[model samples]
Target: MENYHLTHEDGKYKLTKENGERASKVFESNKDEAIKSSKDFIQNQGGGSLKIHKNDGGFQEERTYPRANDPKKSKG
Candidate 1:
């Protein structure tokens, strides 16, 4: 599994996956507002989640990791 990063820029936002494929588009107004709107768009697609954090430098969202199977445990 891999993580992706979404960033806010001038009049638009950017999405970059771990594989390095990037997609960007222009929004109407503020960058932060655009980012939140984009997040909503993604969540509406299906069972998805997103979180925004304000770091010392700027805001960021950390993607969640799926649970892995454990072979050491026997079936009950």
Candidate 2:
């Protein structure tokens, strides 16, 4: 599991994974549909999640996962 942040921009959304990996995708014309699709994509990328925080000039938010519990965390 990992934490990923999704930011909305230009009628699309950008995703950043826990390891700093990033990707972007276009969503449906409907705002709600776009948000749902973004969330689903994040969830499918393992035990991660997404959340909306602010609707500034662009949609901004932070996604967090338990450091000790996330499966993606490095074991040392």
Candidate 3:
């Protein structure tokens, strides 16, 4: 499975693949746009996980796309 992270670096908000040193995509606007873009990209890529960070560089939330019909995470 592909893992991606959205973070702010070099004055730009970027979406970078896990362990990648370079950004896969940079959002010139804001984190929200990057999030939307990441979601669509992940879905098209057959579902994956996205880790999003806030503007201040803090952990925000995570999203997991469904390649299957069931949720991949446990509630407990």
Candidate 4:
């Protein structure tokens, strides 16, 4: 599954998937709603990671869906 990223830009919230350069979805002045939708999209795609970024390109937070769905696993 491709990764999803939520970012705040141009006074709007945008959700972008790894496969595309343009935003896959955009929210009008609502970061919370955009984030929720981004997570739902990743979860629907059989699980993936979501990364939230600040306006200045700083890392905010990351969430991984369903541990089992992560492609990389640590050796026990």
RMSD per candidate (Å) reads 7.8, 6.5, 2.3, 3.1
lDDT of each: 0.45, 0.53, 0.81, 0.78
Across 1-76, the per-residue lDDT of candidate 1 in tens digits comes to 3334555544345554435655533356565676566555554443233334342326565433221222236342
Better of 3 and 4 by lDDT: 3
Arranged by lDDT with the best first, the candidates are 3, 4, 2, 1
Evaluated with TM-score, which candidate comes out highest? 3
Instruction: Tell me the tens digit of each residue's lDDT in model 2 across 12-76.
Output: 65555545745545553555675667667765555465545343544355343332344455353
Q: Candidates sorted by TM-score, descending order?
A: 3, 4, 2, 1
**Pairs that clash in candidate 4:** none
Clash total of candidate 3? 0
Q: Summarize candidate 4's per-residue lDDT along 1-76 as a digit string, tens digits.
A: 5688888888887888767789978888566777778777777778888889987878897777765765566342
TM-score of each: 0.40, 0.48, 0.79, 0.73
Candidate 1: where is the Cα deviation over 4 Å? 1-3, 9-11, 18-20, 24-28, 49-76
Best candidate according to lDDT: 3
